[model samples]
Target: MTTSVSAIVIIVLALTALGYILGRQRALAVSDREKTKLHSLPGYYGQTVALYVAVPAFLLLGVWLFVQPIAIESQISSDIPQSIVDQSGAKSLVMADVRRIANGLDLLVGSGGFTETDLANMRADFSNVRSRLASVGVALGSDVQPAVFEAAKSYRNIGKAGSLIRNIAVLVTALALGAWSWFRITPRMRARNTSETFIKSLLMGSSLIAILTTLGIIGSLLFESIHFFRIYPARDFFFSATWNPQFRGGSDLGILPLLWGTLYVSFVALALAVPLGLMIAIYLAEYAGSSLRSFAKPAIEMLAGIPTIVYGLFALITVGPFIRDWIAQPTGLGSSSSSVMTAGLVMGIMLIPFISSLSDDIINAVPQSMRDGSYGLGATQSETIRKVIMPAALPGIVGAFLLAASRAIGETMIVVMGAGASARLSVNPFEAMTTVTVKIVSQLTGDTEFASPETLVAFALGLTLFVFTLGLNIIALYIVRKYREQYE
Candidate 1:
C-alpha cells in the first residue's frame, strides 16, 4: 500500500513539474503586443497549472483506489460456490477463503508463484468440479454435454468482461482529464488562484480534524467515566475527600483531594509567577538598554522552549528534595520531599517565560503617548507607570496571565513527579498530594483496564478539566473584550 501510494505521489510530482515547465515556456512564447509578458512570474504560473494537473488527478486516484478494492471483492464473492454461501457463521470463513482464492487466482493469471496451501486448495477445487462435470457428461451423453461446458464458460466470460470494462473506463477517464489539464496550460491562462485554492482547502479541512480528534478523546473518556459514575455515585466522586482509586469495588474515588491539590499548586505557581513576570516585563520594556535587551529578552524567553518533561525531572531530582529539607522540614509540615510547595514553586519557575514573554509584548503594545500624557501632567516616571501605563495594559496583561494559568492547569509531568502520587486534601503546601491531570495520566498512561472504575475516573476528571478551562477562556475573552472597548 505504501509503495503504491509513493508511486502515485512520484507520478503526480513528475507530471506537475512537466506541466509547469510547459506552461511557463508557452506563456513566454505566446507573449504578443496585446498581452505582453504575464504580470506574475513564469514559475508561479507554471506551478499554478502543475497544481491543477496534480491535485485533481491525485484526489481522483485516492477516491478510486479506496473504492476499488471493496467493489472488486463484491464481484469475487459472486463466483464462490453455493455450498459455502448458505451457512451464516461459515459465510465469514468463506469470505476469508475467497480473498485468499482471489489473490491466488490473480497470482496465477499474472504468472506469479502460489504458496503450497493456495496450490493445494486450487487443485482440490478444480479436481472436484472436473469429476462432477465428468459424471454429468456421462449421465447426459457426449452429444448433449457441450451445453454444461458452455454455461460454465459463459458465466466466467461475462464476469471477466465486466471487470475489464470497469478498469478500462476508469483508466480512460483518468488519462483524459490528465491530458486535458496538460493541454489547457496556455501562455494566456493563470492557474495560481486554482492551485492556491486547492492547497487552502486541504489546510481548512485539517482544522476540523483537530476539533474531531479532541472530541473523540473527550468522548471516549466521557463514556468510560460514565460507567464509573454508574458504579460509584457522582456525589461521592465529586465531594469525598479521601482518594483511593484501586481495583476494589468499594474503593473511594473522590475528586475533592485531587481538586484541592491542583488548586493549591496552581495558587502557589501563580503567586510566584504573576508579580515576577510583570517586573521582568517592565524592566525589559521600560528600563533595559538596547544592547542588554537584545540578549536578555531571548535568554529569558528561552525557558518556555524547554520541554515540560525536563522541568519535571529537574523538580524531582533537585527542587522537591531541596524544599523538603530546607523549607518544609524547618516549616514543620510533612516528611516527604514530593510536596505541593516543591511542585508549585518549580512549576512557577517553568511558567516564568510564558507570563513574562506575554506581559512584555502587551506592555510594549501600550502607546508611548500614554507615558508622555502622564509626564505632561507633571508626574514622575514611576508614578506614570503605576497610575496610567500598567492600567492601560491591564486587559492584555490579564489575558496573558489567564492563558498561562490554563497551561499550568493542564500540565501533567511536573505535578505528577513533584506533587506526589497520594491524593491528599491538606492545605499545607508541604504535604504530599496528587492532581486531576496526574490521575488522568495514571488512568490512561499504558494499557488501561477499560471496564475498571480507575480507568473511567480519568474521563470524568478530563470533562471537569475541560469545563473549567472553557470557563476560564470565556472569562478571559470577556475581560479582554471589555478592556478593548474601554481603551478604544
Candidate 2:
C-alpha cells in the first residue's frame, strides 16, 4: 500500500512539473505584443496549472489514505466473533494486536496466536483486500463510500467492466487546457489576461501558506485549549494572573502576572535589541567600509545561528550571577539567579540578529538613487540615511520589529532557564519574573494529568500568545500595505 501510494505521489509531482512547463510555453508562444505583451510571464501560468493538478490530487490521496485503514479495521473487527471481542479494554488491545499482525504480514486463528495456516490466510486476505480496493479505485473518480475510502482518486476507468480503468481525468484536463490555450494564442488572443490571472492566483496561493500554517498551529492549540478550558474556568485562568501551576490543587494560576512577565521581558528585550540593532545597521550601512561590511554582516548573522538553549545556558551560568552580584545584589533587589533583567537582556541579545538582518535588508533595498539625489541636494551621508533611507524603509522595519516582538513573546528556553518561575507582576527589572511561555513549559513537560488545571493552563497561555501575535501581524501587514513606500 505504501509503495503504491509513493508511486502515486511521484506521478503527481512529475505531472505537475510537466503541466507547469507546458502552460508557461503555451503562454509565451501565444503572446503577440512586445511591450504590453503579458501582464505576467509564462511561469505563472505553469505554476497555476501545477497547483490545480497537485492540490486536488494530493487532498484526495490524503483523505483516501487516512480512511482506508480505519474502515478496513472496523469491518474486520465487526466480523470477528463476539466471544473474542467482548471485554473491557479488550477492543483497543485487540485492534492494536490485529493491526500489528496484519502490518507484519502475520495472521492469527480468529484473533488468537498465529499459526502457519493463519499466516497463509492473512496473506490471502491482504491480497484479496488489495485487489478489491484497486478495482474500486481504478476508475472511481470522486466519491468513495467515505465510510470506506473518503475520497477517490481522479482517474476514472471504464465503467462497463467491474474490474478497472486507468482514470486520467487530471492528465486529460491538463492536456485539454494546454492544447486549448496553445491553439488560442494567436495575434488576437488576450494572453495578458490569462497570464495575469495565473500569476495573481499563484501569488495568492503562496501567501496563503503562511496564513494556513498559522491557522493550523492555532487550531491545534485551540482544540487542546478548549479541552483545557472545559476542565477549568476562563475567568479564573485569565484574572488570577499569579501562576503557580505546581501539581497542587487550588494553586493560583492567574494569567495576569504571567502576561505581565511576558510584557515586561519583551519590553526590556525590545528596548535592548531594537536600538542596538538599529545602531549596528547604521554603522554597517553608512559608516563601515566594504571590508568591515564583509566581516561584520555574516558575523552578526551568525548570532542568529547560535542555539537559544546555548544562550539559555549562558544566561544560567554567566549572565544570571553576573547581574545578581553586579546590580541586583548591590541595588537591594533579591539575589536570585533568575530575574527579569537576566531573561530580558539575554533575549535582547538573541533578537539582535533578527532586527539587524531585517533592517540591513530593508536598508539595502532602499534605492541608491535616493541617496545620490540627497547627496546632489547637498545633504550629508548621515542626513540622507536618516531622513530618506530610514523613512523609505520604515514599513519593512516595522514589520521586522513586530516579527521580532512575536519571537520574544514566544521565547521559552531563555525565560525557562533564566527568569525566575515566580509570576510576579512587578515592573522592577531587577526582580524575578516569569512569562506565559515559562508557565507553558513548566506545566506541559514532565508527567501531566490532562484534567488538571495546571496542565490545562498551558493551552490558555498558548491561545493568548496566538491571539496577541496574530493581531500584531495583522496590524503590521495593514500598515505595510497602506503606508509603506514602493520604490518602483
Candidate 3:
C-alpha cells in the first residue's frame, strides 16, 4: 500500500506529461490543417491539458488517503468485542492495540518467519504472542487476547482491500480526465484564459491558507485561555502580585510579578542596546570609510546569527560566575549571579546586531541632498546628522527598537539561564527573577493534564504574551506608516 501511493503518483505525473505533449501536437495539427490562427497559443493548450490531468487526480488521491483510514478504523472498531471494551473502559486504547498487533502480523509475514498458513493457525492465548512478536522486533505491552487478535486480523485484511480499490480508482480518474482534456483541445478554445484563472485562484488559496493558519493559532489560545479563566479566577490571574502554582491544589497563579520581570529585563536591554547600537550605526553609516564599512557591517551582523542557546550557555557559565564574584558580591547588590542584570546584559549584547543593522540601513537611506543642504546652512557633519538625518530615520528606528523589545520580552533561553526561575516583585536589578516565558516552559514541561489549573494557565500566559507582542507590532507599523507618508 505504501508503494501503491508512490506508484499512483508516478502514473499520474506520466499521464499529465503525455496530455501536455498530445494537446500541443493536436492544437498545431488543427491549426495547420484548417489554415487558421489559433485563439490561444499551443503552449496554453498543453498547460490546460496538464492541469486537468494532474489537479483532479491529485485532489481525489488526497481525499481518498484522508477518508480511507477513518472508514477502515470505523468498520474494524465495531468488530472489537464489548467485553474487551468494558474491561479497558477506553475503546480508543483497545483500538490502538488492534492497530499495533495488525502491524506486527504484517512484519512477521514480511520477515518470512512464518508461512501464511502458519500465521492463520496461530492462536493468541495458546501461543507465546509476546515473545514471537518481540522476535520480529514488534514490542508488545502484554500477551495478546483472542478478541484483540481477531480484530487485528480483520483490520489488516480490510486495509489491504481498500488500498487495492483506491489505486484503481485514482488511476481511472487520472486517465479519464486526461482523455477528456486532450479531446477538447482545439485551435479556437480559450485555453489561456482558463489556465490563467486557475493559477490565480491557486495563488489566492495559498495566501488564504497562511492567514487562516494564524487565525487558527489565535483561536486555540483564546479558547483554552477562556477555559482556564473559568476554572481559575480571572481577577487574580490578571492583577495578583504573586506567582506560585501548586500541582496538588491551592496555589496563587499570578501574572503581575512575571510581567514586571519581563518589563524590567526588556527595559535594561533597551537601555543598553539603544545607545550603543545607535552610536555604532551612526559611525558606520556617516563617518566610516567604504573599506571599513564593508569589513565591519557583516562582522557586526554575524552576532545576530549565533543561536540563542549558545548565548544562554555563555550566560550560565561565563557571565553568571563573573557577575556574582566581582559585581554582586563586592557591591552588596545581591548574592545570586542569575539576576535581571545578568539576563538583561546578555540579551542587550544579543540585540546589538538587530538594532545596528536596521538602523544602519535607515540612516543610509537618507538622501545625500539633505546633508548638503544642512552643510550649506553652516552646520557641521555631526550637527547635520543629529538634526536632519536622525529625524528622517526616526520612524524606522523606533520600529526597530519595538521589534527588539518584543524579542527581549519573548526571550526564553537567555532568561532561563542568566535570570534564575524565581518569580518575585523586586526593584533591585541584581535580584533573581523570572519572566512569563520561563514560567510557561516550567508549567508545561512534563506529563500534564489540560483540565488542571496548573497546566491550563500556560495557555493563559501564552495568550497574554501574544497580545502584548501583537500590540507592539501594530504600533510599530502605524508609526512607520504615518512618518513614511510625511517624510518620504
Candidate 4:
C-alpha cells in the first residue's frame, strides 16, 4: 500500500513537471519563438499549467484519503454483532480490533505466511489466528470472534476497492485539467493575470484556514463547556468556593478557590516582575552604554529561552526550600516548601525577559524628538525620561505587563512543583495553593469517561481561562488604540 501511494505521488509530480515543459514549449511555438510576441512570460504559462494539474488532483486525493476510512468503518460496523460489542463494552473497541485484524491479514498475505484461500478457510477455534497475528507483530487483546473476523475481511476488501477507485479518479482529474490548461495556452492568453489570481486565492485560503482553525477550537470548547454545565449547575460552578472533583460522585466542583489561586499567584509574580523588568528596560534603553547594553540585554533575554520545566525544577529544588527555610519558616507564616510565594517569585524571574524585552522595544520606539523637546525646556535627563518617555511609551508598557500577567495566570509546571496541588482560597502567599491549569490537567488525566462531570470539568476550566486571557488582550488592545489616538 505504501509503495502504491508513493508511486501515485511520484506520477502526479512527474505529470506536473511534464505539463510545465510542454506548456512553455507550446507558448514559445505559438509566439513563433519570439518572447515579446506573447501576452505574458513563457514561465507564467508553464506555472498556470502546473497549478491546474497539481491543485485539483492533490485536493481530490486528500479529500478521498480523509473520507474513505470513515465510510468504510461505518459500513463495516453494521456487520459486527451486538454481543461482541457488549463484551468489549464499547463498539469503538470492537472496531479497533477489527482494524488490527484486517491489517494483520494484509501483512500475513504480503509476507507469504498465509494464502488468501487459507485465511478464508481458517476457523477461529482451530487456527490460533491470534498467535499467528502476534508473530507478525499484531497483538490482539483477546481471541478474535468469527463475526469480527468476517468484518475485518470486509473492511480490507472495501479499503482495497476505495484505494483503486481513488487513484484512478485522481489521475483522471489531473490529466484532464492538465490537458485543458495545456491546450488553452495561446499567444494572446492572459497567463500572467490568471497566475496572479491563483496566487492571491492561495494567500486568501491560508488566511481563512487560520481563522477557521481558531473558530473550530472555540466551538469545541464552547460545546464541551455547555455539556458540563448541563450536568453540573452553572450557579455552583461560578459562585461556590470549594474545589473538589471525584469520579465516584457528589463532588464540589467550584471555581472560586482555583480562581483565587490563579489571581493571587499572578498578582505576586507581576508585583515582583513589573517594577524590576520596567527598571531594567529603562536602564538598558536610557542609561546603559553600548557595550554594557549589548551584553546585558542578551543575558536578560536568555532567561526567556529556558524551558518552563527547567524553571519548575529550579523552583522545586532550589527556590522552594530557600523560601521555606529563610522567609516562611523564620517569619512563622508557613512551613511548606511548596508555597505561592515560591512559585510566584520563580515565575517572576522567568517572566523578567518577556517584560524587559517588550518594554525596551516600546520605550526605544518613542521618538527621540520628544526627549529633545523636554530637554530644550531646561529639564534634566531624569526629568525628560519621567515626563516625556514614560508617558509616550505607557500604552505599550501596559500591554507588555498584561501579556506577562496572562503568562503567569496560565502557568502549570511551576505551580505544580512549587505551589502544590491544594486548591484553597487564601490571602497568604506563604501557603500552598493550586491554579486552574493544574486542576484542568489533574481532571483530564487517566482513563475516564468523557461523559462524566469530572472529565468535562476540564473543558469548563479551559473555557474560563480562555475568556480571562481574551479579556486581558482586549483591554490591552483598547489601551494601545486609545493612546495612539491621543499621541498622534
Candidate 5:
C-alpha cells in the first residue's frame, strides 16, 4: 500500500510537470510563438495548468487517506462479537490486535511466505498463527482467535480494494484536470491573474492551517481539562497546598504545590539569568569592541545550542552535587543534591543566551540619535546608556524577559534531573521540588486509562500552564505596543 501510494504521488507530480510544459507550448503556439502577443507570461499559463493538475488530486488523496481507516474501522468494529468485547474490556484494544493481525497477514503474503488461500484456510488451533507471524517479525501478545483471524482477513481485503480505488480515482482526477486546463489555455486568457489568485489562496490556506492547528490544540486541552474538573473538585485543585496523586484511588490532586515549585524555580532562574544576561547584552551591544563582540556574542549564544538534556545531565552530575556539598549541606538548608536551586542555576545558564541575544538586539535597535543627544547634553557613555538607551529599549527588554520566563516555566528535563520529583510547598530553594511539567509527565507516564482522573489531570495541568504563559505573552504584547508608540 505504501509503495502504491508513492507511485500515485510520483504519477501526479509527473502529470503536473507535463501539464506545465504542454500549457507553455500551447500558449506560445496560440500566440504564433510571439512572447508579447499573450495576455500573460507563458510561465503563468504553465503554473495555472500545473495547479489544476496537482491541487485537487492531492486534496482528494489527503481526504481519502484520512477518512479511509476511520470508515473501515467503524465498519469492522460493528462486526466484532459482543462477547469478545466483554472479555477484552476495551473495543479499542481488540481492534488494535485486529490491525496487528491484518498487518502480519499482509506482510506474510507480500513476502511470498503464504498465499491468501492458505491464510484463509489456516486454523489458529492447528497452525500456531502467532508463531508464524512472529517469524515474519509481527509479534502478537496472545494466540489468534478464529473470529479475530476472520476479521483480519476481511480488513486486509477491504484495505486492498480501498487502496486500488483510491489510486485509480486520484490518477483519473489529475489527468482529467490537466487536460481541461491545457485545453483552456489561450492567447488572451489572463493566466497571470488566475495563477496569482491561486497563489493568494495557497497563502491564505497556510495561514488558516496554522490558526486552525492552534485552535485544535486548545480545544483538545479545554475538553480534556473540563473532563478532569468534572471528576476532581476545582476548588481543591486550585486552593489545596498538597500535591499527591495515587493510581489506585482517592488522590489529592492539588495545583498549589506544583505551581509553587514552578514559580520558585523560574524565579530563581530569571533572577540569575536576567541581571547577568542584561549585562552581557549591554557589553556586547554598547561597550564591546568589534573583534571582541563578534567572538563573545557567538560564544555566549553557544549556550543556547546545547541540548536541555545535556544541561540536565550537568545539573544532575556536576551542579547538583556541588550545591549539595558546598552550599546546602554546609548551611543546613537541605541535603538533597537535586534541589530547586540546582535546577534553577542550570536553567538560568541555559536561558542566558536567550535573554542576552534578545536584549542585545533590542538595545541595538535603540536609535543612535538618542545616545548622541544625551552625550550632547554633557552625559557620559554610562549615563547615556542608563538615562537614554535602557529607557528607550525597556519595552523590548521586558518582552524578552517575559519570553525567557515562559521558557523557564515550561522546562522539564532540567527539573527532572536536577530538582527531583518531590512536590511540596516550601520557601526553601535548597530542597527537592517538582514543577507542573514534571508532574504532568509523571501522571501520564504509566499504563493508565484516560478516563481516570489521575491521567486526565495532566491535561488540566497543561491547560493551566498554557493559560499562565498566554497571560504572560498578553502582558508582554501590551507593554510592547503601549511603549512602542511612545518610543516612536
Candidate 6:
C-alpha cells in the first residue's frame, strides 16, 4: 500500500519532469528555424506543460484519497453484522478493529512473519488470533468476533483493489495529459496566456478557501450557539451575573462575569502597553540614534518571540507572588498570587513588542514633508513630532492598540496560571478572575455530550468572543478609514 502511494507520487513527478523536457524541446525545435516567429518563449511552453501534467495528477490523487476511503468504508460497513454494529451503538468501532487487523496482517506479510497462503488459510476459530496480533503490536478489545474477522479480511482485499485502481488512474491521467500538451505545443500556441490564466485561477481559489474557512467557523459557532440558547434561555445567558457550569445540568451559564474579567484585564494591559509602547515607538523612530536603535529595536521585538506560556510561568513564579507580597499584602487589597493584576501586567509585557514594532513602522511611514512643514513654521524637533508626526501616525497606532487588545482578550495560558480560574464581577485588580476563553476551555475539556447545555455553552462563549473581536476590528477600521480620508 505504501509502495503504491509512493509509486503514484514518483510517477507524477517523473511525468512532470518529462513533460517539461519534451515541451521545451518541442518549443526549441519549432523556434530554432526562426526564434522571432514564436508566440512566447520556450520556457513558457515548458511551464504550461509541466503545470498541466502535475496539477491534474495531484488533483486526481487528492480526490481519490478523499473518496476511496469513504467508498470502501461504505461497502465494508454493510458487510459488518448488525448484531455487532448495534452492540457498539455504531459500526465505527467494529470498523476500527477491522482496519487495525488489516494493517497488522499487512505488516505480518511485509515482515515475512506470514505468507499470503498462510493468511488465506487462517480462520479466527482455528488460531489464537488475538495473541498472534498482540505479538505484532496490534492489540484489539476483547477476543476478535468471527463476523468482524471475516469483515476485516474483506476490508483488506477491497482496500488493496481500490489502491491499485487509484495508482493506475492517477499515473495514466498525468501521462495522458502530459502527452496531449506535448503534441499541442506549436509556435503559435498561447501557452503563456493559458499558464497565467491557470495561475490566476489558483490564486483566486486560495483566497476563496480562506474566506470559506472563516465562514465555516462562523456557521458552526452560530449553529451550536443557537442550540445552546434553545436549551438554555438567551436572556439568562446574556443578562445573568453568575457563571456556574454544572455537569449534571441546571447550571448558570452567564457571560457578564467573564466579559468583566476579560475587559478589566485587557483594559489594564492596554493602560500599561499603550503609553510604554508608544513612547518606545517614538524614541526608536525619531529620538534614538541609529546605533542605539539598531540594537534596541530587535531586543525589544524579541519579547514577542517568547512563548506566552513562558510569560505565564514568569507571572506565576515571579510577578504574581511579588504583587501579592509587595503590593497586595502591604495594601491589604488581596492575598492570592493569581489575580487580575498579575495576569494583566504579564500580558502587557507580552503585548509590548506587538505595539512597539507596529507603531514604530507606522511612525516611520509618516511623510518627511509633514515634519519639514512644521519645522519651517518655527516648531522644534519635539514639537514637530508631537504636532505633525503623531497626528499622521495616530490611525496606525490605534490599529496596533486594537491588535494588542484582541491578543489580551484571547489569551489563555497567562489567565489560567496568573489570574486563577474564578469568574466574578469585582472592581479590585488584586482579586482573582477568569476570562471567556478560560470558561470555554473548562466547559469543553471533559467527557460532556454536545447535546448538553453545559458543553454547548462553549460554542456560545466562542461566538460571543468572536463578535467582540469583530466589533473591535470594525471600529478600528472605521476610525482608520476616516483618519486616512482626512489626512489624504
lDDT digits (tens) for residues 1-488 of candidate 1: 34545655676677677877876776566565346756566676666666666666666666666676666556545655565456423344455544443333434434434343543343334454344434333221222222223333333344455545544554445456556765665545655665677679978877987998889987876777778789779998888888886565668888888888888888889999999999999999988999999999899989988988898898899988898888878877877889888889888998898999988988888888888989999999889888988888889899888987888888889998898888877778888888889888787765435556777788899989888887888888888888852333
- Alpha-carbon shift of residue 279 in model 2 (angstroms): 0.8
lDDT of 6 by residue, 78-170 (tens): 888799877765466678888999998787777787898988877886257877677788887677788888888888888888888888888
**Candidate 5 at residue 3, lDDT?**
91
Q: What is the C-alpha lDDT of each candidate?
A: 0.72, 0.71, 0.89, 0.90, 0.91, 0.88
Candidate 5 residue 48 C-alpha distance from true site, Å = 0.8
Q: Model 5 compared with the native: what TM-score?
A: 0.93
Model 6 segments beyond 4 Å from truth? 1-7, 30-36, 66-164, 485-488
Model 2 TM-score is 0.63
Q: Give each model a TM-score.
A: 0.71, 0.63, 0.83, 0.87, 0.93, 0.84
User: What's the lDDT for candidate 3?
Assistant: 0.89
Model 1 residue runs over 4 Å out of place are 1-11, 22-45, 56-177, 184-193, 196-203, 206-232, 485-488
Residue 160 shift from truth in candidate 1, angstroms:
23
C-alpha lDDT of residue 201 in model 3? 81
User: Where is model 4 poorest over a 10-residue stretch in terms of lDDT?
Assistant: 479-488
**lDDT top scorer:** 5
Looking at model 3, residue 362 earns an lDDT score of 87
For model 6, the run of ten residues with the poorest summed lDDT: 479-488
The residue-level lDDT of candidate 2 at 418 comes to: 86
